[model samples]
Target: MPQESSHADPAPRLHRVVVIVDANSNPFELSCAIEIFGLSRPELGRELYDFALCAAEPHTVMRDGFFTLTGVAGIDAADTADTLIVPNRPDTHVPRRPDLLDAVRRAHARGARLVGFCSGAYTLAEAGVLEGRRATTHWQWADGFRARFPGVRLEPDVLFVDDGDILTAAGSAAALDLGLYIVRRDHGAEVANSVSRRLVFAAHRDGGQRQFVERPVPEVPDESLAPLLAWAQERLGEPLTVADLAARAAVSPATLHRRFRAELGTTPLAWLTGERVTLARRLIERGEERLEVVARSSGLGTTANLRARLRRDTGLSPSAYRRRFGTAVG
Candidate 1:
């Protein structure tokens, strides 16, 4: 495994990331990898990744043949990367390139973290890395993938699946979710949230691909609890209840519960608690207040309660979270 970059240092060694592509690769999926892992993020205070694009053949024409990629390294580049990403294949029914499959297999054998985005799952499946592992792909290709690779367990509904060494994402937009997930796993929530905010995407979207598949109609803000949510966010320091939220929304508690489920995929209280935890995280990352003060200010009540909540939400105590993500700690 590659050594983690030290936070105390003025300059940190970046983790190497390589994305494999070919002529039939989906340009959107390829761009997703570039946007998340290949882009430089100077705001994080240190270089986080050294990203590159590679192909089985050099100077390959991608997708519609109108856009040609140049100066791309060969498959050997995957051998040196800490992470190797495979973007969506243009057609799931067509056979994958044997050389590309071999490169993916070799990278995994060398213990590099492997990721397959959208129809890219087909590449991994062809490479045999996803055999016996739970995975997912674009919903449109789920049945065909199952038929083609009967050995693999296909979930078909989640946005992504993280099976430790190997990860697979469903569809095109879900590729961003998987990429952000990798950033969070490697750095922390603070850094991932920063990237998400810059991209104008949700840092963590609730529920699975089911909501998107089941509901093709776009949701309007007025039909959602957007106004009520904004009102609640301003008063997170107060001990707000589901009934309080219901009254503020001018609806019965049961109606509010259904709306919360339909809109946020979580109960009202859970959403409120998640908000409090988010507030607590902001306070902790600021490193300006004591634990008790932070707890009280974020409506977590006390230091003991804060500790429990922090552990539950972030798998870290207040001090630990501050140490990892706080501005002062660095």
Candidate 2:
């Protein structure tokens, strides 16, 4: 049975996030929610999210039997949350709690954005929220999930799937990707990048979980591409061609292309363009720099080019981006 909590707010708004915890929940997934949403980031100069942890049952013992969590609010907390997060359950074979599933359904009915991390997608599927919708789970459980929820359109290859109001992440680290993406979508790239920097994690990771599924342990050669990548990053302000990268790496263009595809899962030009956009965004966020200067410094070459690229990358003009994210400097 679900216990009731008196902590429910009378007025609810965006930025209210509730994480649902159940018996045998994965601690790491719960920790991801806590670290991403629950932690206060004063650097953003405002309260970003009002976060809470809610349980399906009171006085629940965690998967690790030694730990007993207490004082957590109940499923009612989720009813008013603007964003409801369901962390990964310990096992897909475990039975779904009816009370928690009902809470999820109700939250969604009230227009709360629902997110599931890792095997937490199973809960959403069990709740029928993922029915006829595209979702993904840990690749290891793909067969079982498919067998159980034949209605779900599962793309086990990707790191995460964002289906408008409903989002699902594939596995542990991918949870960070999805969380950061949400932050980026709601707030902006600058805030998300700040949070990423604080966490010492990549602001964005290229490719998907499929890259890791087969080669769980990725092999990098002794003469790895790290040095070449470092070299390219430092020279992002310059016009870099595949030939230039190949020359720097002392390898032919064909080999360099293969290396980039294998290691980064992207072409040299795409990666370079992304880096340039990142540099341009930082410049825009830091201070009041002229668009021409920003364009030149970021290697976009011209104000018109910068406008196009900025719009393409972030859907915001240079001036608009600065207006929104340039208040804080680090």
Candidate 3:
């Protein structure tokens, strides 16, 4: 909701992403976290974060004993993190280490951002951090999550839940989605897109999308929205409507809406408007001074609409956004 910049930055203070590795933790989600937050992007000529992996024990066995991991920081490393990724182990019935839970509670008390990938939401709920807060976990564990923590609002269907500082992803793959969303929030859409390009992943998949589509593979492969999305992205400056998108896709408006819901779990109009907002934010970050020009270029029509939408999505007015992120060529 309130979430880069062009050119090489002057060694800005990087964010910290400290991950608490648990015994028998699933490595896939941890790998996803590493790809998005830990790895340095030499292509960008600046670092995004100072990352570390902290474990409660000196020798932690991974999922199904695939391997034993060592040589990472201790659990106290979490206390120093700006944003901490909680542990995600596949065995939800097994309780986590009490000290680890204490670390989580301490992190929350200090206002550090917390994240849960897949079954890691259980850890947050267990530590009482998710009490009366929104979260999501792998759909298979949804019923158990609700039964255990009824006070927590569990959005079981969505790919991830971004409830302010605390966030959760529904499954391992959705870990990447949540990570990308965080990148978009921190660096703006342009930098996020650049990261997504390197990952070869879709730039943005909003949290509202269903964790898993009803059909993993379509009966008719050509019915996917990838082509339509590509076509729409290139023309964000144009006044494109749902009807226009439908016509281009050779489907009726009703069909388009259904496909959008099925494929993306969002309406076509909502997707188009979101892309426009991202475009406008990018323009502001890259030194667009004229609000009217940004509005028209992003197809948001007038400056009045631009101000409202930018504030609605970012909690920052157009000029304020420029001040915060603008890279002016003086």
Top lDDT prediction, candidate number: 3
Model 2 ranges with Cα > 4 A deviation:
1-14, 64-66, 207-222, 287-295, 301-330
What's the best-to-worst order under TM-score?
A: 3, 2, 1
Q: State the lDDT of candidate 2 residue by residue for 140-241, as single tens digits.
A: 899899999999999988888888899999888888888988886676667888899988987875434343532234466577677898898898788888
TM-score between model 1 and native: 0.82
Winning model by TM-score: 3
Per-residue lDDT of model 3, residues 108-190, tens digit only: 99999999999999999999999989999999999998998999999999999989999999998899999998887777667
Error of 3 at 28 (Å): 0.9
Could you tell me the TM-score of candidate 2? 0.82
Error of 1 at 156 (Å): 1.8
lDDT of 2: 0.82
| lDDT values, one for every candidate | 0.81, 0.82, 0.89
What are the RMSDs of all candidates, in order? 5.1, 7.3, 5.6
Total backbone collisions, model 3:
3
The per-residue C-alpha lDDT of model 2 at residue 12 equals 38
Cα TM-score per model: 0.82, 0.82, 0.92
